[model samples]
Target: MSKTINIGLVPFSCVKLAEADFKDRAAVYVVLCMKDNNEWTVLDAGQSCEVNASADAHPRNAMWKTHCPAGNIWIGTYPMPTAGYSKADRFAMERKLRRQYKPPCGKR
Candidate 1:
């Protein structure tokens, strides 16, 4: 007999980077993910509303194809960093999450 490990519920958060009142806000944003019950490692990270907007086609979605009954995984964004944050900050956060999660899909 074979045992199956359900991916469990997908977890993610969304942040609206664009603000009509604040022109400085990021039009595109950042996203984070990690496997449930695992150490807090970012399973995947993405920046840019264009990429994020295509949530359904994300590569991470493939990871859950077999593991998750729903054939989907969490792919959401964190609140945009405050005014002090910059594009570099978003990259840095992606790097930090990649370091913590060591997610296979992250850039080398």
Candidate 2:
């Protein structure tokens, strides 16, 4: 299925896609999700916003990560989120990204 991303506490300007729509696109959506959201991962994003986002929120590759800059996950009205970028926040994110993530098999 395409992946959808959860941008919690959203400002409302972002596109909202249904689960069906997320198929085959999950990777793209996840890569585009806001890097600042505490739930940078799909699971976390959903939990933070109480919304089930796309499963593809977690991609298994490095090229995709570079293509989809985390900052591009646009928010609508509310001021942009900054949690993931702060020193403390970034440290935490680095931990999460490293600990929780298991790259696709053989991805190295």
Candidate 3:
């Protein structure tokens, strides 16, 4: 079973799952990298209407890989269906998480 983590008080699906699980989902995503010491670092956070597409086209993907050459990168996602959360709501959540985590990449 996939573990869950809290990001800014919200529960998110664990990282390292198949990307197909998140395809076409509207959600907020947290990019993380696990180091050799088993410490996890927050790399970036963002919200997307289509999580898979957003991830595929992410501008910082290269940077993320550079930070974790061992390929320990993971993505945790909190689904926010369009019917339940407005785009503004998702953006607000993303901003809140970014502020709390202060991820190394993106507009931190």
Candidate 4:
């Protein structure tokens, strides 16, 4: 079963896997790092029309790696189909998560 986490009250599916594991769909993506104590830390968050593509080309990929080991990184997604939610809605969700987490790599 997939794990779920709440980012500012919105539930998101999370996995300790790669971007390729996600479908090519519209969603808000959260990058997290599993700390040595087993807690998770938000590394970055964003919205994308095609999550897989966005993740693959994310500008903060190197920054994320620098903060956590590759094996400890997790990807969280809150899928929002275009038919149901607009781009603005997705962006709003992403903003909410960023505000709540204030991920270090998300500077600016």
Comparing 1 and 4 by TM-score, which wins? 4
Each prediction's TM-score versus the true structure: 0.49, 0.23, 0.82, 0.82
Any runs in candidate 3 off by more than 4 Å, and if so which?
A: 17-21, 36-38, 53-57
Backbone clashes (count) for model 2? 11
> lDDT of candidate 4 vs native?
0.79
CA shift of 1, model 2, Å: 17
TM value for model 2: 0.23
CA error at residue 47 for candidate 1, angstroms:
2.1
Give the least accurate 10-residue stretch of model 2, judged by summed lDDT. Answer: 22-31
Which prediction has the highest TM-score against the true structure? 4
In candidate 2, what are the lDDT values of residues 34-59, reduced to their tens digit? 35543433311211221124333534
Which TM-score value belongs to model 1? 0.49
Query: What C-alpha lDDT, on a 0 to 100 scale, does residue 60 get in candidate 4?
Result: 80
lDDT of candidate 4 at residue 77, scale 0 to 100: 90
- Candidate lDDT scores, in order, read 0.41, 0.30, 0.78, 0.79
Residue-level lDDT of model 3, residues 15-61, one tens digit each, is 56225256797888888886787577878888888787456447998
> lDDT ranking from best to worst?
4, 3, 1, 2
Task: Evaluate model 2: give its lDDT.
Answer: 0.30
Runs off by more than 4 Å, candidate 1: 1-42, 49-52, 63-72, 81-83
Query: Which TM-score value belongs to model 4?
Result: 0.82
- What tens digits encode model 1's per-residue C-alpha lDDT throughout 43-108? 456454234344555555565344444322443444354565676766666666566556656474
